[model samples]
Target chain A: MELGPYLILASLEGAVTAAVLALTAVGLSLVFGVMRVVNIAHGEFFMLGAVIAWWIAHSMGGHPALGFAVALVVAPLVVGAIAVAADMTILKRLDYDPERTIVATIGLLYIIQQLTLMTYGPEARPVEAPFNTRLAIPWFENGENGWQMIWPWGLGTTSYKLAVIGAAMTVLLGVWVLMKRTRIGLVMRATQTDREMALAFGIPVERIYALVFGLGAALAALAAVLIVPIQQAHYLMGGDPLLLSFIVVIIGGLGSLPGTVLAAILIGLSDGIISVFFSPTLAKILATLLVGLVLVFKPGGLTGSSGK
Target chain B: MSAKAKIIALHGGLLVLLFALQFVLPAYHHGNLARIMVLASYAIGYNILFGYTGLLSLGHALFFAAGMYGMGLGIQHLGLSVAPALLAGIAAGAVVSAALALLALRTVGVAFMIVTLMFAQAGYLTVLYFGEYTRGDEGFVIQQAQRMLWGIDLSDATNRYFAALILFATCLAVSLWLVRHPFGKTLVAIRENEERVRMLGYDIFVHKLVAMIVSGTLSAAAGAAYGLLFGYAGASFASVQYSIFPLLWVLLGGAGTILGPFIGTLFMFYLIDLSSGLTSAYMLIAGVVLVLLTLFAPQGLVGELRNRIWRWLP
Candidate 1:
């Protein structure tokens, strides 16, 4: 059995897996950095994004490509607004107590999930693949072409997956620039590191908190838009990603961008590879056990603070 | 009235009311009442960790599931009698819990909470993956719980209700003992100030592991009984939604108080039962109620009631 084309297919699949997780984990890490709340409703925001994008693409009449673009950019902002409202109304009042915040977010998660169930019903809805086309690379085909590559560049292609990867890379680089070289970003970092000192210096820490939460929500929503093509839009979809994102965040280290990215890719690729070889159920068990073992031995995670 | 006498009277009144309800209500309601009591026992265990000890475990259902699966495995496949099966379930819960605590107790706060949740999902999936032993997601049904002793005729509703009542009472007794004990006091101290407790030379890890294991064991008993009561056990028992119930119960009743989880359990179950009868979306109501309770009555029903009564009497 020839394994060359199959290996390329595997890598592409793995890359898509890594990108989706990293996209979602980045938003979670950002939210944790400023607010310190785990945002249990984080997955719902992603769900909303997927649902909205699906609806828009189905309704836009002719070209689905434009619909995909609109979803990548607009859905996130819409979801971000929801996140801002939640942050302003619930989290803002909780005063950043981890317990209360966790409970409150969990409560919010249920509300959102139930609402989504009410709105979408119990069935999983498939989003239209904006471009329904595939290019087959001639590996060991008819004698004329020897391992010749087809058009659309490489062997296999899913426009949706490619779009997702491109969006994730753009988001990561954009966020890095925003965090590393912006006036408000400087104040936000200062506030996270030393809230009292920043407050003493007249920084509007409250506004920063709200903005950061909204930004994280938008990022999660963006990921949701990308994920829908691969996994479809469904109410229960949030449950899997929510658990996976938590694992990624823990593996990456709370509030560390580099750590989150590296951890997300590592976890996502491993999870993908395992799922390819075994049942998704076994993969989840193995991944979680690994995380649990790591916590037992190295509670700080790959790059987390060893404050204790 | 003296506070001790009042407290005793209040508990007595509740017990009497619950017993009376079994007679006054229909058979189904009696079963539900039994279930409420059974579930309350589980919640009481959760309160030990979340309420009194100030630790949040988002995956408490692992213990519940362990007990449930144990009972299912014992009766259906292993051919153990009901009493032995239930004991086996509790033992299973204890073992799994000890293993989980070894890893989970290492982290604290949000790390502990999320990691515990991850493990809970892992536990659920592991059971699902080992479809051979666990029957995969299809689940298994126990024939019936055997008589507690030789020739007791354990099939009647009255016997079941009494059994549940006895178990609930035992759980309450154990909870009370735990809270009042010196070890319980240390748990509270750990909650208040882990750093100071550490400075005082107490091994916080050991204390947390003990609390977690005991909590898991009691919850497992409830889960085992619940499986027998329902006559079925499935992976859903270990899901995060199941984990939420105990936390909700403790909070609704008034965490850090002896009567909190009991009251919370009763209110939540009845509210859901009644609400489900009214609309299909009972979960929505429960979700809303939990949020409102957390926002407005963070101290819970018992706490709020006590404050009101104190104000009125004075």
Candidate 2:
């Protein structure tokens, strides 16, 4: 109703986008960081997460929370397993050659997409959020009787939306701690720093790579699961996330997790605000153009060393 | 005595066979053959950059779409005759590619690829954004009047096939010459090792930029010819799928070889045409083939054959 309420609503929406985008982009960045291979099928992994969540939720046919809980755990696990299998079968065999891997992943994208289209039946299915408590937001109004607080009509949000943001932050914190403090994290960091040295030190680089690939995919899946309740799951829903995540990864610098998160927020918030205020097309154009500029002027991104 | 003469004779024989096939093959399939030839030209164009120069662009669709839409729209909107309109379309492709290359060629490896992919996607988005003028997804058509060139009607099916054949032959000859030329070898050298090429006192940037322009212009001409021959131009022409298709063809047939693109185009086109009848999951086959090809046979059918069966053959 008022400028304050509208801005708040837009930011809230933007926050949700940023939360999910951060998770997905972070996964992409991590994969790049360790493997040094751009997973073109990363978005497909996101789509798989959403679709599997839908399938699991739908087939369970019980309390929405129970289905959601199951999906939240299962989607990421299944997607992660798939990624490991793909990495071993396809990527490993190729020895992770940059160009070939891209083509292979492009093929993987097609295979996954087509399989989903065939089995999933090309329908955009919606999943009910575990909890959707509607809370009306109050707005301050300059009434004749001094400043007054009024519950604005339609100026409300679902509790699930807030939960998404909180849950994502929690997971992100968990990831940070795991990367910073854990033995596996050290191994991964070692692998990222020097694959040859990591191997020489008996780190089992191949196994770590498989695990990292799976972990990266799982993160993307988790994000998809988080957002699927708000946005319907569809077979062809991978392209936008893929492109946006690429932009995020590029802007954040390809291997920097913190950079990915930051760029995600920057892109997500702007995307949300711009789309709400103006046009989605304009938002896309701006993001793409920004990526081009970043590529030309700052290819290393905001956080990482000059890669190119 | 040399590989040059051998290649020339090989091409000459294939050209005769193709010409003879025109009569022996049924008339109903002429249009399909024509379509194959136009697409083959694109593969050849793609091969110059990817096969010869080792630049794998995901944005070749910009040039392809430029040619298709430029030619179709030029004739439709400008009311220009066929030849001039085709030239204009080709010029547009070269210009767009050169512009993109100026920016993209600065980066090498994966960055170059993703950059090109983004640009191609941007072009597709631009087409959609200006949907009113470009007709967006619905596509556009060339008028019959504009299809006439110097009293000869390009709208005629036979004429269209011959025109496409001529274009294919021209591209093939030019490609054959280029590959044999020292300039083409330089591109190959750059592909093998850019640093070495640079250290040899060569201007790699200029060479790469020129490769992009030449390859892009040919693709554009092929795109325009496809639109002119079919009398249709659509948004799909500007899509990433189109870009990938040419790459697939070039790779599948043989990337650097003159006959590779032709064989790849023919094989892939036929496979697709055949498979599209049986199932909608036909693209899965392509994806699998691409994966297998990339892993096992990066050189493609012709390249593999040349390596194994006949080193002297083109």
Candidate 3:
């Protein structure tokens, strides 16, 4: 009812958007970081994850949570494998020439999107969340009782939405640790820093590329699986994620993970708040405009290093 | 035959074929031919930038759409004739694209592509934002009263066909001239190596800027003609799909070659048209063709032909 409570609600909603968007965008940023390739099909992989989640959940015929959990584990791996295959077949064959690969990935995007369209049909399908509990949020009111806690009417949120935020953060943390602490991450870093030297150092550079590409797709798929319950799965759902991912990646600086997460939160939070208060179309228009301006003014991104 | 003579013969033969076909073909078939001509012209404009200049822009749809809307609105609101409306559309497209190119060309490689894509998308939203006038996703049709152009009824299918043919021919000839010109050679050189061109003291930015404006203007002009002839222009015309259409056409036909866009457009249009009724997997063909072409045949049909036989095409 009050402005404070409404703003808080909007931020909470925005956090959910940021959480999913970070996972998707961080993947895009990471792929560009290591592979030097903008994986245009990245969003299609996200779309695939949602579609797969729906299929697995629908077919399992078990408790919704069980299906969701199984999907959580299965979707990313499946999507990751697909990405690896694409990297090998399409990207490697092109020798990863930056321009050629963009076209190749565009081809990949259409291939994956059309395949899903043919198999999944044109309709949007809802995925039942494992748990659906409405938790009413209380807002503090200064009354005779002195700062009494009052349950805000119609301001309750589902438990599942909150879980998505927690889950995405946890996954993002895991990714951070995996990248910083793991040996595989070191190899990827080495390759990014200098590919020929990495190869000379006995690191299987090509193999690491496969892993990184797969990792990017897996993250996108994981984000998709997480949000499919909130938003229905559709064949044509990849476009927005792709567009938003580009916007985030550009504004955050292409290869900077921290910058990406920060930018995602910035964009996702604003998008949610704006969509809630204003029109979604306006939100999209502003976001796209912001990206164009950022690209023109700050070619390296807001926090990204220069000379990119 | 001399390469120049061969080129002229090819152009002359194609022009005659198009002119003669409209009379024999049914009205529906004639309309399809007009679409091919206009879209091929669009692809030619795209080829000038991507094929000749070595810039791969994914945002040409914004320019194309600007033309469509500019012409539609000019005729409706400004009460202009078709010729001036088309010019207004071309000017709108050229200005918008030139401004956008100035900003987008600051970044190279993937950044440039993304910037263009974002700007095009922004343009699409802007069109939607003014949905009242545009009808947004529903699109706007040119409802202006048809007038005579040189004593010919403009609304007649035959007249529209001839007009489109003339537009396509002019664009093709201009593009041929540009590609053969020393200025066009500098673009090819830049595409080959920007650093070397820079070392040679040529202004790469100015050349690229001009190339982009020319490309955008041509695409936009074709778009204006398309809208006027088809009698409608919608937000979809300004969409990513239209942008990709030109890329696909140029890639499949031949990027640098003058007739590559035309060949690619005809081949693709027929393939998609024939396959659309048979299967829902029409786009799959396009995707596969693009992937295969990028991987195996980067030179395209005309480029490949030049690589082997038909060396006189230029």
Candidate 4:
């Protein structure tokens, strides 16, 4: 009811959004940094993840937790395999030329979206959360009682939402470790730095590219799976994530993981907070224009990295 | 025949063929042809920037929508006649493109694409936000009474066909003239090597800006003409799908070729139309075609024809 509690509620929602966005944007940033190609179908991979999660959860005759657990592991792997197949079949043939990659991925986007529309149908379907318990949040008020903690009505979140945030953080941390402390990451980074040099050093650059593309797509799928319970799985749901991820990648200074995460949080939070003051559509319009202006004025992005 | 005479004869012959087809074709195909010509005009406009100037914008739909709304709003709100509303639509496109070019030109490559896409997204949202005027996604129709143009009943099938043809021909001629002119050649040269063009004492920014304006204005004209001819103006035309349509058409038809847009539009329209009859997932066909084209026929149909047979195809 009060401003403090409402702000807290919005922030919590924003945190969930930021968590998902960070994963998606980080996935995009990784692909862009390593491959120097934008995967326009990244969002479709996310949509596929959600749709597959729904299918898995729906088909498995067991407890919701069991189905969710299976979906959590399976969806990303399936999406990753698809990404690898696409990379090998299409992007590899094009030699990862920037313009051609864009067009090709756009085609991939259409195929994936249309196929989903055909099979999934054009309806939004919800995935039952593994466990959902509404936990009321306590707010402090400086009253006659002096800093009394009071339970506010409608100031609560589902246990599943909190778990999503925690899950995203753990996954993001795992990704960071994989990139920083693994040999495979070293090979990928080396390839990213100099493809010809990596080839000369016997890095098996093409395989590394395939692996990286798959890994990036897997990360996006993972995010989708995590969020699918809270947000319904829909055929057209990928557009927002795709646009938001694109904005985060650009604002975070293409390829910078830290920048991507930070930008995602900022954008995600602002999106939630802005909706409190303005119509959701107006907020979106403002955000889109803001991103355009940022790109126009600061091509290098806020992190001061030369994207080129 | 001389190359010059041959080029003229080829374009002239194509226009004549289109005109003659109106007389003999059935009503369904005839209507589809008229629609194709207008969309082809949009693709031609896209080609000016993408095929010729090497600037791949992902937001031509903004200009297209601007034109449609500009004309539609003028007639709906201000009660302006068809001709002035059409001019108003073109003017709106010019102004919007000029402003966008100034900002968007600062970025190059992928950033440029993203910028235009973002602006277009904003434009689309803006249209939805002002739903009272635009009628949002469910778009309003322009009545037959409002569809008259200077004593000509443009709502009539024959007149609509001729109007679309005239629009398509004007766009084709404009593109033809541009390619032949020094200015258009400079744009082509810039596409090949921006650095070299700049070294040759050309103002690269101004050239790109002008190309963007011309491309945008033509697309807007197509949008305006589409709304006028079809008797509808909708937010769907301003959407990302609409933006991608021109790109797909230009790519399929042969990006830089003069006749590529028409062929692409015609081919794609029929492909979707026929496929939709069999299954609802007709876009799957479009997706497959795009991927296959990128893989096997990167040069597109007209581009392949030029490479194989007609070196002077432009």
Among these predictions, the greatest lDDT belongs to 4
Q: Which DockQ values do the candidates obtain, in the order shown? A: 0.59, 0.64, 0.78, 0.80
B1-314: candidate 3 lDDT, tens digit per residue = 77888888988898899888987998777888888999999999999999999899999999999998888888877788877888899999999989998998898877888888889988998989889888898987676364445566666788889889999999999998998899999999999999999999999999999999999999999988888888888998888888788999999999899889999999999999998888897888788888999999999999999889988765
**Interface C-alpha RMSD after superposing true interface residues, each candidate, one decimal:** 1.7, 1.2, 1.1, 1.1
The DockQ leader among the candidates is: 4
lDDT string, candidate 2, B32-140, tens digits:
8888999999999999999999999988999999998778777877877888889989999999999999999888888888888888888888777878778988988
Candidate 3 lDDT tens digits, A38-143: 8889999999999999999999987999999999999999999999999999898898888899998888888999989888999999889999899999889999
Q: What is the lDDT of candidate 2?
A: 0.90
DockQ of 3: 0.78
TM-score of 1: 0.93
Candidate 1, A1-308: lDDT as tens digits: 24566666666787887898888888888888777878888888878888888778777757777888787788988888888888888777777778888888888887877877777777788776677566454555433766554333356766667776887898899888888899887888998898899999999888888899899888888888877777888876777777778778877877889898998888877775667577777777888877776666666777886654
**Backbone clashes in model 3, listed as residue pairs:** none
TM-score of each: 0.93, 0.97, 0.97, 0.99
Ranking of candidates on DockQ, top first: 4, 3, 2, 1
True contacts kept of each: 0.53, 0.41, 0.74, 0.80
Candidate 1 regions with alpha-carbon error over 4 angstroms: A138-155, A305-307, B1-6, B145-149, B152-155, B278-281, B308-314
**Measured with DockQ on alpha carbons, how good is candidate 1?**
0.59
Error of 1 at A81 (Å): 0.8
lDDT of 1 by residue, B1-314 (tens): 88656656766676777777777888888887788888998998898888778888889899999999888788877878888989999999999889989888877777788778878888888888877887767887655444343554444688778777877878877887787799998999999999999999999999999999999999999999888766778888888889988988888998877778888988888888887786555667667766677677898987787687643210
Worst 10 residues of 4 chain A by lDDT: A299-308
